[model samples]
Target: MSVTSAATGSGPSRWRAGLGRLAAGAALITAVASLPWLSGNDPALTVLRARSADQDPTPEQLTAVREQLGLDEGPFAHLAHWLGGLPRGDAGTSWVSGDAVLPQVTGAFAVSLTLMLGALAVTVAVAALACVRTLYLGSRRRLQRGRGAIGVAVLAALPKFLLASLLATVYGVWLGWLPSSGWQGPASMVLPSLALGVPSGAVIGGLLQQSLPAAFNEPWARTWHAYGFARGRVARHALRRALAGVLPQLLPTVVGLVGGAVAVEKIFNVPGLGRLALDAAIAQDLPPLQTATLSLILLGVAAGLLIQALRRALLGPALRDGALPALHAPAAARGRFTRWVVAVCALALLAVITAGLLRDPLHVDTAARLLPPSAAHPLGTDALGRDLLARLGHGASRTVALALVVTAVCALTGLLLGMTAQIGAGLTEVVSTMPAVLAGLLTTAVTGPSAWGAALAVCLVGWTPYAAQAAALLEQERASGHMLASLSFGAGPGYLLRHHLLPAVLPGVLRNALLRLPTTVLVLASLGFLGLGEQPPTAEWGRLLSENQPYVELAPWTVLGPACALVLLSVLALNGADAVAVRRRPASARTRPWSRGTGLRVKSGVSAG
Candidate 1:
């Protein structure tokens, strides 16, 4: 066998190995499916509570409901019966409504599928246009590139919920160009579609901006020009060659789109699968939850399979031609200057957030309307005469707190759930398996779009990536001869985690936490923007945008201030993390500071060579 084939354990062997892993995942999901029975709370009781018109369920009523539910048959027997029926298209009924799970799921799926399709279309259209614009108009033009960067950064950093609200506010409420939030009319789809598609569009656009430009700059481009080909013709040919290369990189964004749909549907009141799942979860309706869970699994698996197929086809061309150079080295750090810029931005963010907390953000001054920066209001006054400075401060506090809370939740959850075996992995898969946008939607369903809901949602969605890192480190450490001997001698999870795992895992865990903060902040601001966060009369960065958007023509500063602050904080968080990570990199490892698994090489709690 060729060395490459041998190294890969290629073809049939690889397939069999992958099948084994797939089966293992299926088995794990099946086991987790049984968790409904394991919970101490009775499904019958929950049903009775949901259905009962009375304030409370009597013991007699509970007993009768249990009898009807066949709960007396023992949990294991009930589970077995439920499992048996699953194959025949019978997923039981809603614990509260007596509706069959299959029908409800099907109905919800139709709506969600439509929305997903629309979102996919929007993503493709926008991304293609963005690519065309960048490739044709912006590649050789620094001004165009810089302008595109600003828009992409803004889109990328804004919270989904916030973006939804802005779309609604301007197009729906202000100009009446479209419906803001609903699924009732065709107009309604525009806002949510844009909201869901824009983020992914930004990602694909950025990748294209990188890939196409690099491809055009290749040595052969000079040869093509030497042969007297037009610049446009050369660019067109280069783009065609680069398409396969960019699509493979875009697969992750496609998958990310699925996750993002969950949140967008909720915000826009689209009666999709995510909304249905959220409803089922809130009602503790197990059948719908099970069906939804399974469907999501299938969706995720399908996306993965699609990506694999695409990669198998197109990846070869890109690989053989070395088309991933732009992908790998698009923006290498510029050394010390980059670090200094990031540090300054971070310090500025800290100062702004801290200063915002010292005063009451809600204190409004009607007399100060449209006031510019003065002795009293550093950020000036809005049309409402609300102190932008105070609001920005309080908003800063809330935004900072939101990020901190999310980071903590993700760190703890990842460490606890992902680092352990079956139980941990299953739990991790279940929670971290949720995309950020979906998590936010589910949180809103549970927490009712309040600030608390946004926080909890961020906490739920942010943890798994880091957790998987910890788990991988644990497995790697355990495989060492000494550790293997210790494990065989009965060293437990706690000992393994503390003695072997921590040294290698701690730095990465900390770095992931820092890296995730900016994302958490974006989500928080988005929730607020959607009106699911803190309600009006409260100053928030996103809320500031929503409030000041109406006065954009009259007093541009109102919209400009909040928008600037939001962008500033996001930029600072990202750069600060990069700078700090750079400061800690070992001499032997000259890779990007933010790259995943870099911390996996930590030696004695420090990044290793």
Candidate 2:
């Protein structure tokens, strides 16, 4: 048999792997050490330099000042010099605060890390509980499944930002259960964490609910039962088996939460990494922006990689031992006509929703000379003569485009990196959990408050999630017996992925990206409202809200119009995603393909001979 050949012969490959790891480590270290010089041109530093320069006595003194800061050196020279100094444990001084930049950034990171961890903890706990209930509440009955699906649909359809805002307003603003608009102590973390975690938890819940039922009903689960295993043991083993399916989807969910937490940071005035990113971006500080972006990327990559590794460990031996079998054939063909009807109905509803925003009917007193909702001007005119409806259509298009851009960029990068095997589990973990606020801060600092710049920043920070998720799926597939089937037929890694792995993982990736679209749009809008995206006269939804804040008392429609559009569009996109998942159920779950006694026995006390 060629079994040993597939599993053995690795000296050269091991050496090559070692070399690659060394190279990656060196590059990351070099990037970290030189970040100060790279990000030194930030507006804050420029102002600091100018201030320091003005106080100088002579040309010699000015030159000396430049020399002292290594401003005279070229960027490469400066980076090298900084890298050289880092081995001695010196990260240099911040031009703004005259403090060590490393320590300050690290301290800021510590605060942000704590917040991220807390939020992640909350999400995991909440999601686990929700998923467990959805899975075990009913005995695999059709009605229970329908209710669970409906719950997921409702949760998925709501926008995270709108959810957070509403929760903040109701729980914090009205009830005063938690402080709103600022961070103080641990108490401040509760509301934002809930707001961020709930939507994320719901996402996890949906995936688990979908995966668990099939996993439990599989032959393996039946085998465990046949062995006289307890229900608890069967449930645990089934969940563990199902988790292989769930982990890949989680990478993006966590990253999305990172983005949401950024908005929460701003709302609550939390000085976490998300806030740092926001501040940096708003101030156009390039150095901070660069640092923040790199940090976020690394964190996200590391997180993703870790998750992938866990999936590999769980799914690997089964593949090597020829236990897990390859799936054959596509899923059942859904009703084409029904799908078309649903799509058409959705489009029609979208049109009606657009008209409601555009056309408004209200009474206006002629003597007041005030514009009320009327046929001549629907939704009324904003402070400017521009129709709210026209602006909204443009805004919706822009929002959707930006969301798609972020999703596309992230997805493509992830696929490329995953295919190339460049982004491993360790890298994803280090990169994906990055503080959204920090990325926003750094980007605004460098890019000078433009939407394109924000989009770029979002892409840079967001790519890790998709990459991590894709890489995890890739590793899981490779560790399954399925990869061996491809190899046995003489398929190369690339061919195997394209023909097998890609098809398996693409559905989950696309579903996740679509689900995340609304949230990304809301993030862009929040940044815009905070004066971090488009400058005035650009007419962005966020910018519109900010401009009309004062007039909110007299006429809230200006602010409400864009807000409604944002909320509605976000909800519509999420609904579409749930619909897609429901329509195209995968083959593995539908047919129960795995043999009862053949696949590796889960640790369910279910003996298989």
The candidate that wins on lDDT is 1
Instruction: Please write out the lDDT profile of model 1 over residues 447-476, one tens digit for every residue.
Output: 565777777866765665565455544443
Compared with the true structure, all predictions reach lDDT values of 0.58, 0.55
RMSD for each model, in Å, please? Answer: 9.6, 7.3
Tell me the spans in candidate 1 whose CA falls farther than 4 Å from its real position.
Answer: 1-42, 71-80, 129-145, 173-177, 180-187, 210-263, 317-327, 330-351, 361-433, 436-517, 524-564, 573-609
Off by over 4 Å in 2: 1-45, 49-68, 84-89, 129-134, 137-169, 181-183, 222-233, 248-260, 277-349, 356-390, 422-449, 482-486, 489-499, 530-609
Worst 10 residues of 2 by lDDT: 600-609
Q: Write the per-residue lDDT of candidate 2 for residues 68-179, one digit (tens) a residue.
A: 6666564566556555665686655544345555665565566666666776787787668767764564223221333344344445444444456666767887788888
